[model samples]
Target: MILTGSRLEVMHFVGEKVEGYMKEFLKPVETYWQPADLLPDPTQENFLEEVKLLRESARELSYDYMAVLIGDTITEEALPTYESWLMEVEGVNQADYDQGWSKWVRAWTAEENRHGDLLNKFLYLSGRVNMRAMEQSTQYLISDGFDIGTGRDPYRNFVYTSFQELATNISHRRTATLAKQAGCPQLSKICGVIASDEMRHAKAYSAFIREVFAVDPSEMMLAFEDMMRKKIVMPAHFLRETGTKIGETFSHFSDAAQRLGVYTTIDYIEIMESLLNEWQIETVTDLNDAGQRARDYLVALPARLRRIADRTRIPTLEYPFSWIA
Candidate 1:
């Protein structure tokens, strides 16, 4: 649905929705994720050495795949765009409030950069650039940048991160499977590690949003409805230089491959269901009339997603992203 109304009108309702969700959920579940173990060994020198090795390994594989995936340029074209977007949408625009958010983005970027680096190196070391196809893909992807609205809505940001993180995990896992199939155990191992990290990243957003749902179930439910209606995009969408192709990719998947991959709509709904159940969103007390309506609406999300999947009749391939369609 189009957000056709005045900005003020939109913000008013959205803000109330946010407030309600936060008061009822976010505030109540304010405890953050904090692990007690410092590192694998907890010895500073050994930890540092291990981290350095992991970083070096990741960098190598990242560049190797980047070269294979985007031609042998290694120009860091997409990095700048991502950095700019990160700066533009620093959650809620408060310097103070964004410290953690900023740090998270930075760390994620740093890690992601290594993926490109390692991929490029591997391609360079092993000669794998399909120049014409890779360059064309990159050009198309970069021509259209990912669009994050100017509203600086934190919850929207939250939603974006949650899905994107999961998408990345899915991508990495699939890449690993492909690598293993191609007889490269090393690449598969590296991607497997990266996929683990991506899973954690997804959990962070999922858990945080669960807290938001707790803070104000009514507002969160409404916000979720609004977000689902709008649909979310990946951060790399605008930077990959193949926006059209990427969209085509999604469309193709929707039409013929959704049931094939772990990223299918059914998978997505299941993740949401797991999260809501873990947070006990349905058990929250004293929901207002609006909240009740929102709850009823959410109750249909799984069925709706399943119906869409069934209607599409996309073949269910055993491996993620392995569908021919």
Candidate 2:
């Protein structure tokens, strides 16, 4: 993306494997479970009664849990921004319109499209969220877009997606666990499925990075280091509520997530650690001096991050979210 000649070549090389990766990572649309399968059907005879029961189960959920769920849903519902951004990446779309990279992005977006659909419908049935307010927030997030600092660089974008997918998997898995504990088995199952999808996607993206590291170790290492230096910003960093300024709602939403232990600083450090191990970063060799220093910074990063994480405190204050009223 930065006028690097090899970047486009590498993207083409990876694009060649799209068919295999698709088969391995993506489920067929016909066989895949749609949101309707997990949710009550409106056309069913007992649909009203089923929704009543679903609402009853949702009532048992904690306030923080509900808030975090709404935030996650909004983040997922802003899929259009992510898809558009990815499609514009340096080499992803420079090839044929029907190329593997384009197909992968579309298919991935299609699958991800269900996540927000399912969650939004469930929340609507739950009767806990202010749908109008929540919908407005989602619209704001998409309209506002975000600055994750990748700037169309495929290497940097892959790194961001790899970390993000794992983070979402963790949060969704935890939410699923809490949902089961809160006696909402249906929602728990829904989150479990979504978490599974995230895991598969994470594996796909991470594998792509692993391959890049093998061929372009120096550049790959530099990109990874650059991202860590930039501190991979979450996709929902621009999250805000109705009447709120840009990014004003993220702090409150993050606080709710931290308070609920759904997604926190500790979890963030763990994900970073896991990625380092997943990529075998410590073992990588053949780098230039700058790349070596970048590797060193990444090597000591987990401990440094842990110490910082230890000193930080999640705010004890609770804020009322407009989306929850």
Candidate 3:
């Protein structure tokens, strides 16, 4: 859908502050942690011993845990799709390389690049993952892309990202806790740092939406409500394994995640509620009649989702994921 004049105007308005947001939300390259910092170094003479211990710890991880980890890795590895999608947003055109929004996207991608790298290398050293099959799924996800209902509107896209980044933070944080409990301190630390990055990114996206709300509360409110109405889709929903049709692997992956409590339907509701409270949806004033209705729907949505969440059951049965060795 074509953006309204007001939406386009607000997008440019928000884009102008991209530099300030980048500095506030992102870290300097020199000071940031690299994947190599957390992994066993090949040049070190003790690398072999470290790998042996890593593999031993990885063996102790449950099947469900491994499956969820692999799925998370695949989604993170599909950074190309995400960057391309964001670059195509209303005012964040990548072709305009000089724009601050484009600069922010590139810098954000730089930080995110290490997540998949760190996790994949850890998995490889752990020797508990089917590397080829996992690689295939990642490739498939990047190729298939996804339709997240955001279109090119910056308002809807930011709202989606705000929810998504927070969701990922929760997932990774939970995985970190689980990893530590399962005797993999190193892996736990890896997830911990990545989760931290996700939270910072979440804050940045949330800030963008808040800025838009300040200028265009009515449109912003409507966009957020529209997104929640459609539901935010995880990019992993497009995941596929070898010889399987698109999205077949997602059901099994999601089940494994649910079974493991890595990411759950309840978590979805909670994230939505968090966004609602953080954005002060109920307090947004001066909205048009339609915008007011959208705000009402958004405010009440969490409780509605909670009722559904309470009634829904996660399957006790586990589906075999090809990504696990």
What TM-score would you give candidate 2 relative to the actual structure? 0.97
**TM-scores for every candidate against the unseen true structure:** 0.61, 0.97, 0.97
lDDT at position 148, candidate 1: 48
Candidate 2, 1-325: lDDT as tens digits: 2224489888887788888999999999999999999999899999999999999999999888988999999999999999999998988883567899999999999999999999999999899999999999999999999889899899999999999999999999999999999999999999999999999999999999987887778889999999998998889999998888999899888998898888999888889899999999989977888889999999899899999988998888887898885
Go through the candidates in order and give each one's C-alpha lDDT: 0.50, 0.92, 0.90
Clash tally, candidates in order: 41, 0, 0
lDDT of 1 by residue, 39-132 (tens): 2244565765654443444343332233223321222335555655665552422254434445445545554555545544444333334444
Please give, for residues 1-325, the per-residue lDDT of candidate 3 as tens digits.
Answer: 2234666677787788989999899999898899999989999999999999999888889989999999999999999999999898887878888889899999999899999999999999898888999999998899899999999889899998999999999999999999999999999999999999999999999999888888888888989988988999997898899999999989888888898888999999989888888998889877889999999898888888888888988988888788888
Whole-model alpha-carbon lDDT for candidate 1: 0.50
State in Å the error of residue 270, model 1: 2.9
Best by lDDT: 2
